[model samples]
Target: MNRKEFLAKLGMGAAFALTATCLGSCSSDNAGETGDVDFTLDLDAAANAELLQEGGFVISNKVVVAKNSDGEFVAATVVCSHEDLEQIVFQNNIWRCTAHLAEFNQQGEGLNANGSNGLAIYQTELSGNMLRVFS
Candidate 1:
């Protein structure tokens, strides 16, 4: 190839390589844990207004807290078991990872190939507008 053509190809290849590297490393590895968790949310608080609606959810303290369609509270780690990425959220009354699309049930059991490791679940209790999530 001509010198100019070769240099152009080399530059394009370098750009592609850099893009790939950045995409891989730019994500946070904040998923997979926070041992011995024990926290509470006041249902009457504006920050937790979602809890008042069935099938709504919020993420706090590295945990994804949700109110199922049945108006019951459930909790799980805000991490995908497959890649340990903090992309877990509640949708359709179950846990889903936006990064890799891993899915888990309320019981923290994997529901798909990408969720093979399952998820870490927490115990929840509700009393007088207070919701407690514990390990």
Candidate 2:
């Protein structure tokens, strides 16, 4: 190839390489988490609202729904990773384990640094005021 044509191709190749490297690094930072887990609860037709308001309405052997600070609802697993005790308590927009006092935010993010992990969160959907959490 001519000298000018060779230089043009080299410059184009370098630009493409730089673009690929930037995109590669940016995507790698977000690779850890796939997505949030989901769990769904089917409340019985005669389910008592008062019981739900009191919290600790067990959806199954693995899940529970509780009201957050806004009175909106959220769900998480009742199983505590620390001691496998079902001690999840809802108060002030957070879920706390009464057994060991491990705290987690509404989105299931660990709020403490005491080696206590966050509760597992389930994605919620509302259908006519009925909240559905998928597992």
Candidate 3:
């Protein structure tokens, strides 16, 4: 699909369309130093309950780990495409940047309004009681 159509399908309005120049810098060259995920989260850890609870999330190591409204686990790089801030907040199944109000859905689709870019979503896997997030 064309860029415009792809953006539209993600709920990104015309204003948020990504130009060729901007698209080139949307994400980092390296998502992980190694092929493996950096950490293994304990699902039973009390400290992680809030993040694992529905509609809750936590930002650390430039990544956001959240439990969306559906109680499904989701993860994404927290760096804002607009200003490269790690200040991302998750609410109502959407991730928003505090610096520029850039918004993206759980599936990592950038929304309209601030002309910001989408975040890099990661794969979340549940293995026994541990949750692993990877690029």
Candidate 4:
């Protein structure tokens, strides 16, 4: 190839390589390292029957603790399944996603157009007044 043509091709190749590298580094998945996220909820303070009846349900970016009608305490992640956003809010005994307005029952069942892919329900164990949640 001619000198001018060879130099132009080399420059174009370098530009493509640089663009790919920059794009790879800009991914949201690389924002942080995923680690074990474990949290404890005070069942007495969080999952009382009176509160559930009064507030309907409790949804927060933080872990939610609630007792079913069977008197069993339940805890689960409040993170939204759609976009990993903390959009779940507790009102009227149901969990609702603020982002897409998707609603879920206390059991983490989706109740809207975004059904099927529900909230992430973590395993919970109660020890006295505290409920521990783990993946």
Superposed on all Cα atoms, the candidates' RMSDs to the truth, in angstroms, are: 8.2, 17.8, 9.5, 15.0
Question: Which residues of candidate 2, in runs, are more than 4 Å off?
Answer: 1-61
Give each model's clash number: 0, 7, 0, 3
User: Residues 85-126, candidate 4, lDDT per residue (tens digit)?
Assistant: 665666555666665566777677778644346665656677
User: What TM-score goes with each of the models?
Assistant: 0.76, 0.55, 0.68, 0.50
TM-score of 3: 0.68
Clashing residue pairs in candidate 2, if any? 38-134, 38-135, 39-133, 39-134, 39-135, 40-133, 40-134
Give residue 29's lDDT in candidate 4 (0 to 100): 25
Q: What is the lDDT of candidate 4?
A: 0.56
lDDT of 2 by residue, 1-135 (tens): 999999999999986775564444322121112244454444444552532554434444456677654656677776654445677666566777665456777777767632145567776687765567775
**Preferred candidate (lDDT higher): 1 or 2:** 1
Ranking the candidates on lDDT from highest down gives 1, 3, 2, 4
Per-residue CA lDDT of candidate 1, range 1-135, in tens? 999999999999986875665455444333366677899999999999998999889888999899999988999998677677789999988899887677888888879766767888998999899999999
lDDT for 91 in candidate 1 is 96
Query: Judged by TM-score, which candidate is best?
Result: 1
Superior by TM-score: candidate 3 or candidate 4: 3
Q: Between which residue pairs do clashes occur in model 1?
A: none
In model 2, state the lDDT of residue 83.
46
